[model samples]
Target: MLRPVTRYADDLSYVHHTGFADLARGAARFVVDLIGPERRRVVDLGCGSGIVLRALTDAGHEAIGVDLSPAMLALAKRTAPRARLLQGSLYRVPLPSTDLILAIGEPLNYLEPDARPPALAAFFRKVARALPRGGRFLFDVIVDAPGRPLSRRAWAAGEDWAVLVDTTEDAARTRLTRDVTSFVRRGRRWRRTRELHHVRVLRTVDLRRLLRDAGFAVRVRTSYGEHPLAERRRAFLCTKR
Candidate 1:
């Protein structure tokens, strides 16, 4: 077998789009409300499969989406045809000047470069430079909280696709790993794809300090408003002030 890809592929993206859709669907209302009826330019980093892009466009925002996975961007194109979809990493992408930036789904956590706090600190500076005073940087980060599980296995299935994931969290090292295998039905045959994802457990305190250093006023919350994110995932609303 080939070495597991580090990012989402076709089958894996499809599985997530179909099976874990509650994450995107549940986030729609709360995120939209954060837009506050303004027709602002919104850039979505790691805009997977475009569910939130569709929501942003439907709400009249000029939405630009960036992701490293072409497979995920393909689905996102169909999901939000009106939104401009760019294939690029959030860490390396040329982010456009925008009134608001959305990095929902913990997009900042999974990329390998973010293994260090300085990488994320540089990213925050970039985001700060890409926005003007009063602009918003709304995103979430996964923290290594106390009493969290060390390792876990989970699975999700749909009519034509299934996903199995083995997750390992190391608190001492501040890392999270997911070994994911996806099986998708293709013309009466099942195709399997595997990918490994790693997330750095960047602390909220460090991230808040970085945001503040980058000229943002940061607030941490468990939810956007009504939609409580999965455990340990905390949202940050950073306004350039």
Candidate 2:
């Protein structure tokens, strides 16, 4: 079930401030701790709205963000005016050599199952070519939770906006389909937007193997913070070998 990669267009607006600021800030702090306060250049792959980029710049580090959504990039530019923002995909983007590379927010999961390995290999090769030895890469993936039923969730922000998400898992529970619908207040009217996202869930062992084959020394943790299992997201810290 290989589907063409879909870009987030109108859906970007719905997620710009989707209540994940705390998590983004936490991830940023963890990154700073790992890299120290040397003010190194950092590139955030799939950096939606520049949340982490803002944190990086505020910490006195040079930061750049790359994302596939122009709408998201626009918001990012406005939010993190100090950081450079680019519109592009993770697979092929012109990026400078950096001290650290971030691909958080389950970016890799967006790829289809068959595309994950080759795409990840190319991603690692690009990072390797764009970084010096010992450079670090940090990313996260959503691990499959078997026996979890189809989940429906909703969010509302006063009278300004509302979102509904319905998630359906494949029989094998290795793939997820997310159907999102958003309603935003505009003047006296409410506008609606809808998007469908497909994602693949990868086990920790699979992720470690990918990183190892890509020439990295990898470490996996349940969370980036001091807590071991605060969230379902698993973080991968890799150093170029």
Candidate 3:
């Protein structure tokens, strides 16, 4: 079993094209619209590098970020010194009272099936205890489709890198497994990395049901509106009742 590798800011500059700005905008709009006057305190769940949290704070909203990757958090501190960053997993968030909560960039898609209920329950419990009535809990994930090709073969074009990855789905076990191998050439040194990610694939209906059970009502489901690049994932916006 392989675990996901953590990427630092320097690494992110080379890997992610938009970096964090694209994610920040989407989350900011959702939180501002949902929390209205109460959007003072925003929690960025799975806040890799605190990009969204930083954006929210710059816009005058207080922000807190939680992530499992310490390497990423280190970079986040340099960029968003005003926001509080905590080292923690999405399944367990430590906070009290938030105007809005966000888990963007397909973090929730990484949970396994049996683990999802508990994770979602934990998220809901934390948000419920921290947020007042009518607060918002928003998240997004890549809709799972079995036997789908994620990319082509591994290849490098100049300094840019690309690879093909896929996830294995076990219907009987309700389990989804992700595997990847990527390599980047730095000067004369060739750096290669591989990771194994195990996630759960909840049906659309089942996901909604879990949210409802967690004390939220469906607000909207928006297809990512970014430059055709985000067409690969689905975004779900839910609100606490």
Candidate 4:
């Protein structure tokens, strides 16, 4: 069975942080720019392995990273040692009082979105509650779009590890499921691991409306600053009124 929304495990987290951190790295500049020169408390929701957190701290922000994965947070410790890190769901964790909240890599799309309003209205409201007037939220989500194919397969490799992902969209269910397999060099041999992840395919219109109702002024974008996002995905730059 495909896994429901949950914290990433050891192998996948390792592979992702090591081999596929570029997107987060690129988004970091855009994130840092948005915060300006003033010191602000920034909370990274689902911070993964802290590529962005590193950038945030390096730019002089008070940074806090929250993730449900111990493995990922462990990596964050090395990447941004000066930042405070916590382990918990973005939806359940106590968001540190912050001027910015970031959920990059479309973390909210993996919420196992059941029957509540899109954008997970309650969670958006919680974020709104945590922010003061003019607080910012930078995040992205995979959405049903004009040219998204029904299935996709890709692979990435580093000097010591490699990963393959096969993904399929279930339009009827409004979700996408990914089967991830990884190989890590342990000695003379490579160890293999596999897992599945599911993400809901969000509707952009619904997301915008929900965010607006949650008290955010939302701007939809197809890129992070000048760094282009993958097709069928969108970033939401939201500000609390």
Candidate 5:
């Protein structure tokens, strides 16, 4: 059986300090500018908790989000009751014409190797099928250089857990190896769970190639937020043909 593409059982508040809401809003504004004001129809692929969806809507765009996790979509609905939210995979989203598609938060890197290409292909086909002559897709990805020392690392406070961080050899992939350490709580209980993920490290070259194959003219810019594209993290700007 295939693994469900979405997972949102835990509280997303864990990653709150990552500034998901602010970052998504900034990215949305950038996409709208690149795609133009007239094209206001947008979709948020892998929209977690509908943060990006909320951001897009606040910017006066007709934005909806599609996520694989029903739990996450439920949270999203609670967060943005007016925004249209869908529970589905990126590989299979049912919708009509859209002017812009945004997928951020390094969501693309979470796909397994074999599932990566096909997922991208399907998403591209959907976007192309929906878009007119000049539409755009903006997404972000993380790159990992295997065997490299940790650049930025942090632990979830109040838990005896350490999050191991490393990028794969290709510099396009990253893995968040969760190292679970146990500590007694109130001298009564213990908690532990190890979450290891082997996700794709999408490379710029391969990503561009895939976009071209999917009928997109790709332009790799450092994020619109002015972050430099390095061996770790960055964003891509793609215009569908």
Candidate 6:
């Protein structure tokens, strides 16, 4: 159940491979610390470029990476040659029995508002069936802030490529729209690509409720590491009860 990638997928993968390795490394470390030396099989949902999977494998765990974008999967294959990689949609991807399932990098944000609950429920059911009683699921979500001002951001990769992102929220603030434009150097010429993305925002209470209904005992942290205040991005650690 794979879907076609957005126009920005190629440039996004390129940027991730070139500059985002440290972010992935930090996430991997956080995950490792949280789970300890269990030596359990790990599955990384929406595993772009297999950075986390690579780290897990290096730490002596059997790791598998799953993603929908072919461009991302290609980079993952190159970056983590020894790790197993699969390309498919999260909703229908068949995964092996695992001790930990990771859905990082804003994968859930991509679902529409109405589809979020059902999709999460289905995902939880699948994980419940695939994992043992003490298995764990770790994920992060972006908290919604109503009336947030629109903003535009940009990033560059030396002289080869650049990406511009314009973000705006819906009137009700339940959905966020991002218009992205990428400029890439192609030999003597430059190529421009544009893509529009719509993401839904979820409340912490609703997310906790959904996980509870799906048979998990959930704990949330404002940040992955120690922090004094809650941040927009929150992480959820769920264990099968």
Q: What is the C-alpha lDDT of each candidate?
A: 0.83, 0.75, 0.62, 0.86, 0.61, 0.74
**lDDT, candidate 5, 88-182, per-residue tens:** 77767676678877787766766542334346666667777777777778888865434453334344434422233232232232344322222
Stretch of 10 with least lDDT, candidate 3: 223-232
Candidate 2's TM-score: 0.87
lDDT of 1 by residue, 4-47 (tens): 33478899888888888776776667778877886989898988
Structural similarity to truth (TM-score) of each candidate: 0.93, 0.87, 0.75, 0.94, 0.73, 0.86
- The reply for model 3, stretches above 4 Å from the true place, is 1-14, 17-25, 29-39, 112-118, 144-164, 170-174, 185-188, 224-232
Clashing pairs for model 5 are: 144-167, 146-168, 172-201, 172-202, 173-201
Q: Identify the candidate with maximal lDDT.
A: 4
lDDT of 1 at 145: 58
Q: Report the poorest 10 consecutive residues by lDDT, candidate 5.
A: 177-186
The sequence of per-residue lDDT tens digits that candidate 4 reaches over residues 1-241 is 5445455778788898988887898799899888899999999998999999999999999999998789999999999999999987788887767899999998888753232323388889999988999999889998887885658899989999999989988856487778788999988999898877767888899889889999999999999887899989899999998
Deviation in Å, model 3, residue 137 alpha carbon:
0.7
Candidate 2's displacement at residue 59, Å, is: 1.1
TM-score of 3: 0.75
TM-score of 4: 0.94
Decide which is better by lDDT, 3 or 4: 4
> Which lDDT tens digits does candidate 6 get at residues 21-100?
66566678888787788687889988888888888888888889888778899988887887898987776888788899
Location of the lowest summed lDDT over 10 successive residues in candidate 2: 111-120
Q: In model 6, which residue pairs have backbone atoms overlapping below 3 Å?
A: none
lDDT, model 1, position 120: 81
The root-mean-square deviation over C-alpha atoms between each candidate and the true structure, in angstroms, is 2.0, 3.2, 4.2, 2.2, 5.1, 3.8
Candidate order by TM-score, decreasing, is 4, 1, 2, 6, 3, 5
For candidate 3, lDDT tens digit of each residue in 22-103?
Answer: 6656665655555565348888887776677767777778888887767668767976889989986766656767777788
